[model samples]
Target chain A: MSQVPPEADLATQDLPSDERAMLERLRAGDAAAFEQLVRDHGGRMLSVTRRFLGSEEDAQDAVQEAFLSAFKALDRFEGQSRLGTWLHRIAVNAALMKLRTRKSRPAEHSGDELLPKFLDDGHQATPASEWRDGGLAALEKAETKELVRRSIDALPESYRIVLLLRDIEERDTDETAKLLGMTSNAVKTRLHRARQALRALLDPHLRGGL
Target chain B: MLSCRELVEFLMDYCDGELPPEQREYFEKHLACCPPCVAYMKTYQQAICLGKSACKDEEQKPPKMPEELVRAIMAARQAK
Candidate 1:
């Protein structure tokens, strides 16, 4: 989750000297500075987009667009936060814009099937089983990491985006709501449900039953 | 004691520490005796931790940036 604070302290004067110099160079239209910016941040930006957009091609396009957008807005950057932080927000928005424009992938899971079921008496239909402590550490393995990513990608678009914004990107509820054009309540509900569904999807693997 | 269904329903609030004191007390009272709900809460928390760690791993071992992407963005910036 993003440890970047919800409110970035916009005291440009407090920016580190190196970042300040980079901002100045960017604002001065130094070609090398712009290229350097891309080289420095592009990989991380692409990673952010790749999660939002599972397609490599789309992720590349979104990162490309994000860099261009950032370049165009260079004058507006107040140096309040680290340049990387600003770029992260821009990258996320670019990916979301791409998500809005594209058609949904075939065979996406609506995530409803994975949600926990309850009986008429307000009890779990199936009692929850405990996975051994530290069982989830399997996610560090290459195959398990892929499984985790695939599980996230399997979620429905709306819920997936909410999950990405809230959990992965660590955007606040109000900001995520604004970004998705939904109410905070809606974001919270979707985030909670998304977590539940994702938990169900990973249960077998976590339980070593996969 | 809160039923398992009600506990699950407000699970997010409880975990987030957003539930009011009374409701949270009831929620905990239920968890104190219900082994299943305790397991459910632990797994649910672990799921969130796994998701964040999985994504954060990308930063530790970032995917290779395609050279073409760098070229394209630079070209676009030059055009602008």
Candidate 2:
């Protein structure tokens, strides 16, 4: 599947020498350099924030906040990774914090509450022989794409976040682990479980054809 | 010898090319001898293909960077 290459490359390539020099100038109170930095990273930041927050207003606010936060912390910029990755980290944090606040408000589970019951019994333990019976059939149907999308979106936030970062965003496992504060092994384990859950969700549709 | 269940557990890692080389070799041997495992692999490969096709639409469309919004952001930064 063709994906829009991550916007993170913008700062990775475009800035560097210029950005570091500009940042040095900003340290000396160069407001114009700071403005250039903002113009360079702002839209990409907004896009990443929007993917996580799912609201245009929230995304815009998050991007602004991320820039403000980045500016205040500019002295601490370690340059361990690309500026885009650094800024994206801030954007992701802001978006997640926003999501957490939204989750704090009482909300219905939307039937997702019942899924753990099925999962708890090790329904995931079903043998491959049994899985073969119908799993392929479900996948072949035209609506399978929509089903897969909804299934992914339905995953618990923790699993969904890891899957998106590790799989969809194509972040390296170690990078994802660092981003999530997890060990690489833990990331792999969660990713494996997440894929299993997705497979289970698709099974009913695929089973008939198998 | 890995049980069918154990093989199934490793199948996803296999598909992702995440399996360690030694373990991958072990699974390849198992696949060579096990018809069920081969079929299982086929099913998984198909699932991945379908999933990729499905997810492409979600990921490919570049997010719209509205001219007004970009202008507003640029303007705000300029005024800062």
Candidate 3:
């Protein structure tokens, strides 16, 4: 397993009772408590934002924007969900907005021109022969990673957004569906298809004989 | 016997623990007697493992929060 940093692991831990109490106080109009909440959840929010936006600069801006938005909407927070969940909702929206803005600008090369050509066959398995030659293993892995990223990026915007929010970010299905304004079944179907598409992209790189 | 496509779809939901108990019982019963589905399940599991390994290095790292940005946020909050 890849080693996650202790601080990052700590960020995922349940909030201490003291912190939760502070958050409740913040909900009751304590400015200091609000600041503490920012200090606690800011890193994790930025981490998630970076995953969505694919750039550090954009992630920072998104985190800042998300924090501001969260502060403004504090009154509306129902206190049913965890504070982290609420902040994450804000961060995802901020990141998606950034993506939309970037999309509006014409790209130097259209995505159609850069997409890989692959045959569609329900029965075809990835060739085991390609995984041989240990010397090329590293290069193959890099290519596979790029292929998976491209495959994900190729999904329809709605599908891609839901996949990122639900799978990569580890949001519960109900919360994800609510955030995307989708039914839970719709979210599940899209997620299943998204994983299938990703698997198809990766099939050619598997070493084990299929 | 479930076709390859149906098996794969069921396995997708199964692996995620999303299948309802009744549906899960049906799939498990089918898996008990079907050689091809069992083989297919192993391949699918391996494929997911390989996929994760292949992309593990590419996992995105969180960006460092700039001191200035943090300070700015703090300042903005104070002003508000």
Q: List-wise, what DockQ does each model earn? A: 0.75, 0.26, 0.21
Q: Against the unseen true structure, what C-alpha lDDT does each candidate score?
A: 0.84, 0.63, 0.60
lDDT at A147, model 3: 57
lDDT of 1: 0.84
lDDT for B74 in candidate 3 is 73
Local accuracy of candidate 2 as per-residue lDDT tens digits, A5-99: 13322332345787677668867767777667666777677767765665688888777767766766776665556676677678777776666
lDDT tens digits, residue span A1-210, model 1? 222224345756778988888888888989999888998899999999988888999999999888887877776677677899889888898898888888866876577898899999888888888775554657757787777888887777777789999888888999898878899999999999999988898888777533
Report residue A64 deviation for candidate 3 (angstroms): 1.4
Q: For model 3, how does the per-residue alpha-carbon lDDT over A40-126 read when each residue is reduced to its tens digit?
A: 777777766765766678878888878877777765555555677667767877887777566443332322322222225423232
**TM-score preference between candidates 1 and 2, better one:** 1
Candidate 2, residue A15: lDDT = 54
Predicted model with the maximum TM-score:
1
Please give the lDDT score at residue A196 for candidate 1.
Answer: 92
- The native-contact fraction of candidate 3 is 0.13
Model 3: residues >4 Å from true position, as ranges?
Answer: A1-17, A20-39, A55-57, A74-86, A96-102, A105-122, A125-159, A169-175, A181-186, A200-210, B13-63, B78-80
